[model samples]
Target: MPAPTHLLIPYSFRRKGILLGALLGILLTACQPRHEQAAEAATPPVGHYEGSLNAAGQPEVRATLDIRHPSPGHYEAEFTAPGTLSFVADTIVFSNNQLRLIRPARPGQTLALTLEGDFWRGALTLDSTRATTILVKRGVPTPSTYRAEEVPQATGSAWLFTPADTGTPGAALALLPDAETAPTAAIWADALAREGLIVLLLPPTDSATAAAETPRLLAAVRLLRGTAGADTANVGVWATGARAAAVAQLLTTAEAPRVAFLMAHNMAVGPASNAVLRELRRRKLAVLGLYGGTTASQRATALRNALGGRRGGTVLTFRTAGPDLLRPDGGAFGPGLPGAVVEWLQGK
Candidate 1:
């Protein structure tokens, strides 16, 4: 006898259910790439990339790209080539494994690169020129660019940077914290050296007490005076972070003499007493005060007012520079900052 019609009906329903499941599987299979693409779009591949660019008839140019995501859906980037190119882009677009570096000016596209295996390879489109570029993610060392020699001091060792072209280069003692803790400070010293300034980068102590640290700083200053390529007559002090106040104190010390100028970066003037300002003014110190961020203008103005219009007291506000007196990426100085610093030094 044939099977009951009710059983056959149930079997037919089971077959339909299997076909429905197959259709759902196909739909999910088709949507998998879309889901993955959405995920990729949400999380951009932002990083620091260092590489070289090749143009049709020009020398190969070394470049560095820094992409940062400070907030949700907000991105900032910096592209730097020591002698070739430099720009900071606040607007950039990343999609489908492609990155577009948008210029704030007309003809928007600056660099159009695609994510390849361990590299961002593409063309740099600037004006009428296009260059083939390949970048590998790497941490470019800060002090690697300049030649440094260790000069042992009573307190510690100082890295001496002498200019190759100038026998008597303008000297500045960098009062920085530990290099491991503050790498940007080391970069600042290297940047000054790159501009042909003789820099004696002194090792910082654990203590920030002016009275305790001034002696060591003064000893390093004296050592800078005796250094072969350093110009003792034009020696100055470069201070950043908490060391700025101590540097001001150092200048007031009896042992500290022949200190022609003082360059303070990102220093809070609130910690400095009025007496210190008065003394600095009495000495006719050539002071360059640089403050950064939103309150830069106000801080700079306050410092200027504290100086009471002392000669050679030039205070500038770099809206884009970080607390370290360098661009956010720490790859280079802010707009014309290095040149302005060098010009001021030459005048002194």
Candidate 2:
């Protein structure tokens, strides 16, 4: 009777016992632990997220996560949208199944994240700039710390305080009393306060000689941005000079100095017009031009064609014409050309 068993079973020993049980089920799934087989192949979780427009046309946001572990790698998640981006909890870390997060900056940018656990599931990928960050991995789920807005400020009535570089902080100790100017730009603000560069002049919110010095020059442009990191603006055409050439001809029309001061060595301001230099290159600034006398090669050819387009904006000209050392002559430059455009903007 044993000889009758499947005609003596020799179909190559039943195809080597089903290929040795499929090579021991692919060597126990390649010996597990790739974030636990990507959290057991994203099982029984939840997910959904969405956003729109990017590829530089701007706006690309995301967030959709649904997970439930209740233990082990520990997780509980849900979201459809609620991420402006912020992180720190358990320093978030993952591998293979891939997930990562890191953000915390004590003075400027430091946002980060990595994605693909179904970016909010349907869609969510915001990145107006540096794109903030995001990610979710393995049993995938992420969304927490998405409420941190506070950037709606204006302090406007006029302020100007810029300088983090440009002729190296020579002018812009902030101004706005009709944006100061007169004779070579008011002796380039007294040779940029005798070359130490720190002036806070004021008087024109429509000066009746600024009754009691325009609230002490608008309290030094509103507390010099919590003191010395400067950079403030509340302008309508405040001076950088040819008397803010009609607010530098409406800063060549629109978006004037949201932050400006590029370079001015091949200098400018022959009374603002080429249609106010094309509305100051379509209202975008942060330009500076200086190249020795007579509007230096047309302020370095209209700041090299309005900062060479696609608007990443800025222009800082000076391959020469700003080192005559112990300068200030031509009746000491100022008292002549708007006090050398207010001592090259107070950095004299």
* Top lDDT hit: 1
For model 2, state the Cα shift of residue 68 in Å.
Answer: 23
Model 1's lDDT to the true fold?
0.59
Kindly report which residue stretches of model 2 are placed more than 4 angstroms away from their true locations once superposed: 1-134, 137-222, 228-268, 271-287, 290-297, 301-348
Per-residue CA lDDT of model 1 for 53-158, tens digit only, reads 8878878989888765444433445666763245444235666677766432223337888888668999887667688889988753222223344444445445
Cα-based TM-score, every candidate: 0.57, 0.22
Instruction: Give the backbone clash total of model 2.
Output: 56
Every model: Cα RMSD to truth: 22.6, 26.7
Task: State in Å the error of residue 13, model 2.
Answer: 70
Weakest 10 consecutive residues of candidate 2 by summed lDDT: 11-20
